[model samples]
Every structure is written in structure tokens, then in C-alpha cells.
Target: MKNILTLSLVTLSLTACVNRDNQYDYIETPQPNQVADLQDDDTDGVINARDLCVATPDESEINNEGCGIIITSSNERHLHILFSNDSADIQPIFSSQIRQMVEFLELYPETSIEIQGYASKVGNEEYNLALSKRRAEAVDRRIESMGIAADRVTVVGYGETHLEYDGDDEMSHARNRKVTASVVGYQGDIKKEWTIFSRLPK
Candidate 1:
């Protein structure tokens, strides 16, 4: 009877101690400010709260922040062809430019360009529009002769609508007669350009 009484008391004391410690040491779990399952709008595999770049490009390898780590760059694809007044003939001085067009077309077979032709602001708008168009076609013909398909190069005459030099003076007018273009292509979803450089004989 005496041993039974002592065991009961000891058990009660242990239970009391445990309850007291639990009351002091126990902590509640913290709740988040946002919902746990927000949408990944960019499909970058990261949720909005954790993603620093929310609109990451598709298929770009992303970090925890959902931004691309693949470093990329862009090169200028500007094309310019200067012309003598009233002449649609491409000068011999632009041989380098012609090669540039040919090589670029060969490399990216699917790419195409629209040659925008411009004339000096001093000429008649109607007449200049026609002249500019001829200039654009002249470039197309040159490129077409070099072996790029006719379908790959399109031409448009903007005339003096968008001028490099917006003045009616002689020098400024001379500066405005030109054909220009830019070329671009996509291997996957990435836009790409190439610059073919040649070393001139010193």
C-alpha cells in the first residue's frame, strides 16, 4: 500500500512538470502574408513572391528569382545605301555593303528585309515617292542578282516621309537620298544578328 501511494505521487509530479514546461516553451507556427499557392504568370517555374523577374522570357534558364542567367547581346543590323540625285544605281563604293547583305541572307535563309528608300525633301512629294521606290527596287535587284531569292527582299519607298536630314538645302538634300534596312531572325525564340568583318589591305 505504501509503495503504490509513492508511485502515484511521483507520476503526478512528472505530469505537472511536463505541462508547465510545455506551456512556457511551446510556440505557434507563423503565417505567411500571401497565399501559399499564387500563380507563376511567366511560367518561369517560380512563384510571384519569390520571383524577382515576373515576366521572364519563355525557355530562358532562370534562377530562383526567375530571371535569365544566360547572358545575351544584340548587334546593330542597320543597312544604309547612299545614292546620287536622280540615280537609282548603287555606287561601286558600297561593295562592302552588298557583300554584307549576301552573307547575311545566306546564313539566315528564313530571314527577309524591306528596303525603305528615301529622297531629298527638296523634290516633289509625288515625284520623290516614285524615285524613292526606284531606289529601293534598285537595292533589291542588286541583292537579287547576287543569289538571294526574290521573295526574301521586299522594297518600300517612304520618300521624304522619314528623312535623315530634314532640311531643303543642297547638302542636306544630298544627305537624304538613301536606302536603309535592318535584318533579324530567330533560331528558337531568341533574336540574333551577325556582323561579318573583313580586314582591308593596309
Candidate 2:
């Protein structure tokens, strides 16, 4: 009877040990869901562990990993300033247009501009090219004087290559000899004004 009791006790002890070991093995094993949590389902250059914005669109500009599209706002203005025949000087009647440009530049500090000068078909090719260049430079200087950075402005001479009016009339020539200021490359929201000729009397 004593031997039988001892045998029964030993059997019980071994069974309990086996059950405890099995419990520990179950706890240490990783599940399928846990493994998937560490994987990146969307390949947006961001891992699943730290990605705030999952499933981002491909080829979109993002400022940070997993972040949404980065947008840049800009306003483009084409301002025409007509010049007198054979001269690069800005007319005094266009002072209001210059003031408007100054106001715009002040409102949008990140804006940059390109001043393109054009001349009528009244002079030789070389003379027209130089005159156009001088007109553009004159406008560039005027803008610079209004506290805009010099580096932000680009001056170009289109000469008679891009004439607004091709006819041999006084009004056509007046329209051809002009400078065009284009504001571009700005970031964020912008308030654009009407073009110079848009407000002028016909």
C-alpha cells in the first residue's frame, strides 16, 4: 500500500511540471498578428512602427516620412510697361504701376520676378537688343530701389523677337516697346493683382 501511494505522488508531480513547462512555451511563442505589426504594409519610405501617415500616394512630395503631400502656392503676374521710342527710361505716368508692384513684393516676401524687355522694329537688330536690355535693367533697378533683393530679380532682353503688335502703326509700336515683369517661384498663398494694362483706359 505505501509503495502504491509513493508511485501515485510521483506521477502527479511529473504531470504538474510538464503542464507548467507547456504554459511557458505557449507564452514565449510569437503570434502571426504580432509579426505583421512590425512589417510595413505600405512602401512609402516609412516603416509601420513609426509611420504617422500610412498609405501615402506614390510620387507625392512629402516633407517628412509618411507625411501627406507637400504643396507650394505661388502667384504669377505679367506686367507690361510701355516705353518711349529709342529710350530705356520709365515714364512718370507708370508710377502707379510701380507702386502696385512694390506693394505686391512687400506682401509676398518669398516671391521672385523676371523682367523681360522688348523693343519695337524701329531700329537695327543690335541697337534694339541693347535698348531692350537697358529697359529691363531700368525696371530691375526701380524694383530694387523699393527694398526688394537684387538676387530675386532676373533681367532679360527679348528685343524685337517677341513683338506684341507687328503692325507699322504708332499704337502698335507703342505696345511693342515694353517691359514685362513676371512674378513667380513663390511659396504659400498669394494675392495677385491685375496686369498693368488691364486697368488702363483703352
Candidate 3:
């Protein structure tokens, strides 16, 4: 009985010591979830943060973080004018469209348009080259006559090189002979603006 009591006392003391020394601790968390901050570049209510020019810029514009840039937009660089089998005359029907574009450019004095001309694959390479150049120059003169500044218009020719359409048929050849009125540095209607807290570049 004395041995039994000694064993019980020893077990109780061991149990008490184990329970006293038991340990526990809490773990810390990392950074929390957050949203992107928006800022106003243009005074327009639409934040520039959501602007297409900021998120995805066309060839004409580049997004340097929050600060935006306007470069030459590729879409406005060419206006094709079809020739009469081998002529460089600016089509009468296309005149009105050219006039409207010139007027828009006039409104934005800082903007400019580049005119490119192409010819069909009918003539010899050298002839086609000269013809295309003439076509582009013709369009440039016509636009200049409309009172647009000479400096704002650039004329160039790309012989039957980059055809809009390709085939052995006349229809395809017709497509090849054309001029382009490419407007550069002109921003469309400012439908929205973005206000973004841009991080400074390292």
C-alpha cells in the first residue's frame, strides 16, 4: 500500500509538470488584398486609369505609366485612290471624304496626315513606282489646295508592293491601286479620363 501511494504521487507530479510546460503560439499574416488606385489625368470625370490609351494604346499613343504619349497612329497613315488602269488622278467621289478629313486636321492644327499611294501589278516595276509616286503627289496637292498646311501633309508612294487585295483578277488589281489618308497625333473624342496614382519609375 505504501508502494502504491508512492507510485500514484509520482504519476500525479509528472502529469502536473507536463501540463505546466505545454506551449502554444499564434502566426502572423502577410500583406492584405488591395485595389488599384485611380487618378485624373484629364479633368474629365472618367478616370484615365480606365482609358484605353492608358491600358492598351494604339500605335499613335503610348502609356508611360500614368503619363501618356501621342505618337504616329498607323490607322490614319493611308488613303488609297484607284486609278483608270494607269492614271494618278484623285477620284472625284473620294474628294468629299478627303475634304472632311482635312477640315478635322484644320481644327487640330497640331495634327498631320501622311498620304501613301500604291499601283496595280500591271505596269513594269519602274513605271509602277513612278506612277504610284505621282498618285501620292496628286493627292497631296489636292489636299494642300484645300488650304491644309503644306508642312502637315507628307506624300509618298509604295509601288504595287503592299496590295490591299491579291489575285490575278482585275478586281484585285483595282484594290491594289489606292491612296491612304493617314492622320497622326489626333485623339478621338475624349469619352473618358483616368486618374491613376502612378508608381514612380525606378
Candidate 4:
């Protein structure tokens, strides 16, 4: 009788797992649970689960670590300043041009510049080298005096080397004797991500 009762209980348990029509028919299947979505809410190319900084601004420059990075965008400024022969001194007339460089640095405070000074081949190579550096410094001083920080300026001189015009004409020599610099500015509108509590209706 005990074995007969145990067998009846096992049959009932097995019948519960199968369809009502247990005559070699298909078994019943439970409804599947829905899966959650993992998204890049900040849109910095990193998923929210792995993103440490969901408040990334602009999302322009970002690392795999999911944080904001400084972006450097290249811009070039050409100043028309013709220097005198055998002179490293910048004239007062070119103040406006130098001011423009200062403004460029002002627009992008995080950026620093290497002012390249060039010299004509008219003088001794050694003297011209020093003169070339001085020319770079000449612009550096002017820029610094115009409210730019001195630490942001790097002066480099190339004496009779990499001349804009290799010819010996006055215009060619004047073109060679000058300073050049490139600018890299931070770009795009900085937009902060909406936090969980800080988010509001659109």
C-alpha cells in the first residue's frame, strides 16, 4: 500500500510538467522574462554600465574609460609682418598682428605655442641662428606684454634654414625673416549629461 501511494504521488508530479493531453503531445512552456537594455546614455561611445562619467560634455573627445577628454582642433593664422634685413627686432607697426596672436591664445587658454622664427641667408650662419631665435622671442615678448601668459610661448629659431623664399631678393628675404605659429582651439558646445535625480521632462 505504501509503494502504491508513492507511485501515485510521482505520477501526479510528472503529469503537472506535461500538457493536459499527455498522450505523447508537446510540453507546456513558461513565458520568458523580458531583457533589459544597456545603452550609451551620454553617447560617448561607452555603455552606461561601464561609464564612470555619465556627465560627459559634448562627447567630442572620449576614451574607452568613459570620461571626457580635451579635444585639440587645428587652426592657422597668417600675419603679414615684413622684418628689416639683419634685424631680430619686431617693429611697432606690427603690434596689431602680434595682438592677433595674443587673441588666438586668449581664445584657447589651454593651448601653448612654439613660435618659429626664421632668418635670411645674408648674415653669418652662427649669428643668424641666434638672430632667428631672438626674432621668435621678439614676438613672444609682444604677445606676453599683450596679456598672454609667458609660460604659453615657446621660442624656436631656424637660421637660414627652411626659408619661405630661398631667393636673395628684398621681398624674398623679408618673407624669410618672420615668425609663424599654429593654433589649436577647444571646439563645440559643451553639454552636460542629465543625472538621475537632476533630469526633468522635455
Per-residue lDDT tens digits for candidate 4, residues 1-202, read 9999999999988887777676556568989774643698887788887788887876245667788665445666655455788887788898888788778778778788888888888979999888888888888888888898888878888888888898878888888888787766665444344555565769
**Alpha-carbon deviation at 70 in model 2, angstroms:** 10
lDDT of 2 by residue, 48-111 (tens): 8777878666554444566655456666556789999999999999878877887788878877
What is the descending TM-score order? 4, 2, 1, 3
Give per-model TM-scores. Answer: 0.55, 0.56, 0.53, 0.57
Please, what is the whole-model Cα lDDT of each candidate in the order they appear?
0.80, 0.79, 0.70, 0.77
The segments of candidate 1 whose C-alpha lies over 4 angstroms from its true place after superposition are 1-76, 188-202
What is the Å distance of residue 33 in model 4 from its true position? 20
The candidate that wins on lDDT is 1
Query: Which residue pairs of candidate 2 clash?
Result: none
Q: Pick the candidate with the highest TM-score.
A: 4
Clashes of 2: 0
**Which residue ranges in model 3 land beyond 4 Å of their true spot?**
1-78, 184-202
Which candidate model has the greater TM-score, 3 or 4? 4
lDDT, residue 108, model 1: 73
Which residues of candidate 4, in runs, are more than 4 Å off?
Answer: 1-75, 191-202
| Model 4: lDDT to the true structure | 0.77
